[model samples]
Target: MRPETEADLADMIASASGPICVRGGGTRGVHLDGAVLETGGLSGITLYEPGSLTLVARAGTPLAEIEAALDAEGQRLAFEPMDHRGLLGTSGAPTIGGVVSANVSGPRRVSVGACRDFMLGVRYVDGTGTLVKNGGRVMKNVTGYDLVKLMSGSWGTLGVLTEVSLKVLPKPETAAGVLIDGLSDVDAVQAMAKALGSPFEVSGAAHIPRGLNGQPVTMLRIEGFAGSVAYRADQIASLFGGMSVRVERDPETVAKGWAWVRDVDTFQGTEGDVWRVSCTPSDAAGLGAKMKLAALLYDWGGGLIWARVPEGTDLRTRLGAFDGHATLVRGAGQAKFQPEPAPVAALSRGLRARFDPKGILNTGLMG
Candidate 1:
């Protein structure tokens, strides 16, 4: 089932007797045991204001289409949403709905925000077969409940989004990367935290073990005017004096490198279990140290750790105590999402019941 408009989506939802799998671009999702409802037919940009840095588009609009439109206006999605096809081994153009539904964000997320932060408004068809709208095109249009944030990262459990409004940012004049070589994971975490703490305005920070010439490479990114970028690069090098530092000014190469980290590219092609762990920057190294058998890629100045562990290894049990959580991005044995605590689990169930009394939308996708 594919909906071409809001009315069509509502009608389809109302008539459905059982659970339905919601698909957007079909790029990212777990397998579901229900009739598939594709959103690709509901596509196109509704509004774009380059001057205001706002864009409104139907949910099924291709992500590439939105990016091209923003690029033409010298603007971009500040969240730098990631493309999951590479890591998931799925072949489909990513869609705006999928980006929002998954709340995808790249390396720049540490600086700006995630997909939910940029989302201004949304129009979705709820499980009750009623059309619900929240927020608006402008930044200050939050008049009531912030349903925009709720729909995001909901995995289509609450509702099926039909359209979305987003806030964009102007592209930086230039970007430069400071590469510090030969730092161990512990030292790399400390260095990245220091760089992020300083006033140098580091926008992206990542460490790849055995990623560069068989040695650990710590990368710090800064974006701004050419002169500002040059000065910051030098200052960063001075701060980490003992290490080998190289500044990359080429935008293409710098983008490719960050994209690799953002999309978990290192874990690509290798057939192994991948886990994403989020914890305090100071504790990332300690947490990673426990996973001696896993390959690691650190992002967000050590706040986000991507691990390629052996299949069937239960991460939550192995890494006993931690400040944050670990999510199984791709694996066969363990559950995809961490189990929410009892209180939080109850709240989640309550929300799901309120929004989806029939529970006909993407049933069991979140579990």
Candidate 2:
């Protein structure tokens, strides 16, 4: 029950006999079932070279503070991690280290990649009580291995990340989203694919399938300068012809529109079972084709699907058709987890074991 300072982590690891969870702000507290290693006290920015476009901060620093400082200089962490303020019923002050530990990348992930991409270096206390450092403040060649990337989405399973260094990108001059309405799941996927492949860079494309009575999916987002976005919107519109595409402009409007895509305010399925299914866009349409009663929808250009089903149905059988896997997001009583970790996941686990031999961080979250 102690807050880990830079020096204290080693001692903390030495004392713990079993697995340790790298707790951060306790934002996702309920999701874990282990000894908590709270990270909020490990706060403050260590180094920020604005000219270098790289910054280093303690793992426990609040993400909002990081964003505000970067925003002041017209720069930002490109992956755009979403704040689970509303969803988890906790303060939106997610720690920067927590973001890295969980790899909380948002819609911008479609373009800039995830939190792992910006990771330049890390300082962590591994299991068996070892404090190690890797990479550098600036990007360059590595001699052999890279644990920074390994810990990006490890969900604190490997080691307790104490400090993080990342390269940031300037915020776009202008950003906007073109909401192409009425297109069913099939048409939306085709449209998103087309926009993403075009000359103009469409940063994000999501096909939010109609849910419940009349909720329409918030379609594609195209960023960059206003003129370029408008031009791209027109070119893509030609493909749709008569279909009504609602184009939204300005940062405020764009921010409001992306709320759903960001999973900001819509975590209401807490009352029932919610499943987050990740699959290729091609298979999404057919995977849940037989579910006559489940309330389901799609997002992230149809690659991420959200479904809330009646309590008793077996999720493994229901979502087996889709080539991808589903992780339970809400509601009661079941181990609907993907016990068989994907090949990539096993490789990730190996990397974790390499960094954390004692299995003293986020033990069962990975299992």
Which one wins on lDDT? 1
RMSD (Å) of each candidate, 1 decimal: 1.0, 2.5
Best candidate per TM-score, number?
Answer: 1
Model 2, range 66-139, lDDT digits (tens) per residue? Answer: 99899899899888887766654565368999899878888777767889999999988888778889888878
Worst 10 residues of 2 by lDDT: 264-273
Question: Where is model 2 more than 4 Å wrong at Cα?
Answer: 31-34, 211-215, 288-292, 341-353
How far does residue 319 in candidate 1 sit from its true spot (Å)? 1.0
lDDT of predicted model 2: 0.74
Q: How high is each candidate's TM-score?
A: 0.98, 0.90
